[model samples]
Target: MQGAVGELRTLSEGDVAAAWALEAAGYPPEEAASLAKLQYRQREAGELFLGHFVDDQLIGFVCGTRSLEDHLTEESMDVHEPTGTTICIHSVCVDGGLYQKVLQNSSKTNSDRTHSSKWALCETEGCGDPVDGQ
Candidate 1:
């Protein structure tokens, strides 16, 4: 059967099963998050978690936290000051058949190796269209 178009949504407690299912399908068994961690992130403030669903079933996710730590700065800070947002894509996976399509559509262009977390923002703003499948 042909897979349906994927939809994006903020992950919620109700989606634990679907999320775990996707994790099982996408990664090795040892890597999947326990249900408790999933629930905690959903309730945590300033945490951003997004999932891709096909016909109401979770198929992929991009979860991250905003931190004040500068990835490029090695110097220790005396006092922590929140700076620009850091969006870490914990994972991005799709069914085997759709891997190429997902990669083509989801990758970010002009990605700075110094700041990997900015890719999510770049992809969202369409800043790097070269990698996106038009």
Candidate 2:
């Protein structure tokens, strides 16, 4: 891949447009969250919204919310506590420029902020499918 790695950081409300556009490009209508919805999410748990930027452009992201439930539901998307044991990941969207093989080659991802050790990778896995180019 020609692309170089970007900064991995927590996204704030200022990045909403980029986040919304990225979501539109990365996910189908049935799956993509609306700007209002995204804004609400940011209000709920902005700390959980993470993004990858290349040249200051959003390329990918992983979004989630802290919860008490061991399992996930549609309601999980609407509710997010600032502190919780369970983190329900809602989406993982990557840029169209990158390929699956390249992503597979990538490992040991990191974020600038510190999180709790008690928190596990609560992967609310989406339908198993390859990332599609826009």
Candidate 3:
């Protein structure tokens, strides 16, 4: 949260670079997903790719693909199954500094609202079944 509350929305092709940047910065180099992978997610599973924006700047995101697998696995991470019913969330990244600020604010309300809405969208998409976070 900055001057205003952040809003969550579907990420599109245009948001890929920003999303990749946040991913790289939020996770260690070894754990970060490659730009190509992010690009693939944007192109193939755009519905599951969500960005948290404040003043139109991408600060965080949650991305994944639809899967029939019971849990997160190599295949789920690499492929998008449009007909699948389970969501395999690949990343949940937030800008480092902003994340700290939210913790300091000590209010779960904002974070909860964001996650709730995200899951709500997943449910609507018919892929709300939780798989282990990857």
Candidate 4:
């Protein structure tokens, strides 16, 4: 199903459940972050947690924590370093039916270095994989 037009914004506490839903749906259970882990990231590093909302509902998200480590590590993935310069992206999830639509809409703005640079050093893992069968 095609979602209504959406906008990208920093995720908030209100978005926790919706974000977790997409996370669990888009990844294998072993790869998905726990609901508690998602909550911790939202609380500790909200600035790094970006979500795509369609008609007030979350359809996609890119969530992570800030870290000093050059690459994603067990410590960086579990902890949010307030003063860190690197962004260890943990989840990049999109609804199964809305992958192409959401990406087309978000890419124009999100691909800009200036916008992404705000988060700094985005070390994304599995960002290239398709979340849906598409």
Candidate 5:
């Protein structure tokens, strides 16, 4: 894990290339959002897009939207209200070789926090794995 941390800032037009690269490395073309769509989301405040880079190269990303709904689906796309209800961890992807590193980093970041109210949701083999603890 030899890398520097970049600020997890809001997405911007300048980040489209990096974002597209991250998505291409993780998902199929049809499943990933276009750079324009991502930029639009950032402009509209419709989603939270965070990027993780190493040596100025994008290697991972986490994106989600705040919503009152518990889980996200296609239907949820129509609802853009930000209620701060749930910080849904919609998409989290790391370069194929860096999954473990990303997971460890995430666990470390959340480990110190008490497990009383947080619900962590992750996907494994296309199944939602919800864990309620630190």
Candidate 6:
């Protein structure tokens, strides 16, 4: 699925490899997640992982999971909870040197979280929406 600004699509089963490449490139070896971990995140909570593409080529991504945990941890890197209230951002990697390794910030309580919450800004003419599996 292509968006108005390049493509703003969520990562799918077939996109694990590409997502892994981005992770490895943006994160240190110790900080980077294993392929299996990445796969689980995509399978379990992929809706939170959005990819950016130029001409259908993936150049960056924003990924995370739902969790009650307040802070980023090695364990959080491998887990996702669907019913979790807090959005634990795992990573945000942009090709233009704007790579945020892990969402190191502690979680905050939110009773009114919605999809409209701006995560990644899709830079294109009138295209700020992100595409999920829907």
Q: Residue 100's C-alpha lDDT in candidate 6?
A: 44
Q: Give lDDT tens digits, candidate 1, residues 39-131.
A: 555565213456667777666665434335433121211122234343433445565456555444434321221243443222222232111
Instruction: Please give, for residues 1-134, the per-residue lDDT of candidate 2 as tens digits.
Output: 24576676777889877888877887778778889878877778777677777788777776766666554545667788676555555666777665343233222232224243223242334322222111
- Candidate 5: tens digits of C-alpha lDDT, residues 19-61: 7777666877766666765665555543355556666666776
Q: What is the alpha-carbon lDDT for the whole of candidate 4? A: 0.69
In terms of lDDT, model 2 sits at: 0.61
Which window of 10 residues has the lowest lDDT sum in candidate 2? 125-134
Superposed model 2: Cα runs more than 4 Å off: 1-3, 97-134
lDDT of each: 0.47, 0.61, 0.67, 0.69, 0.53, 0.58
Clashing pairs in 1: none
Please list the residue runs of candidate 5 whose C-alpha ends up more than 4 Å from where it truly belongs after superposition. Answer: 1-10, 45-47, 77-79, 103-134
Candidate 4, superposed: residue stretches over 4 Å from native: 1-3, 97-134
The residue ranges of model 3 lying beyond 4 angstroms of the native Cα positions read: 1-3, 96-134
Cα-based lDDT at residue 24, candidate 5 = 68
Q: How far does residue 8 in candidate 5 sit from its true spot (Å)? A: 5.2
What TM-score should be assigned to candidate 2? 0.71
Cα deviation of 38, candidate 3, in Å: 0.4
Comparing 4 with 6 on lDDT, the higher-scoring candidate is: 4
Q: Report the error of model 3 at residue 52, Å.
A: 0.8
Least well predicted 10-residue stretch by lDDT in candidate 3:
116-125
**For candidate 6, lDDT tens digit of each residue in 38-120?**
88888888777767676776777767776554444445556776765445566666665534422221111111223323232
Candidate 3 Cα deviation (angstroms), residue 114: 15
Model 5 pairs in collision: none
lDDT of 3 at 71: 49
TM for every model, in the order presented, reads 0.56, 0.71, 0.71, 0.73, 0.63, 0.66
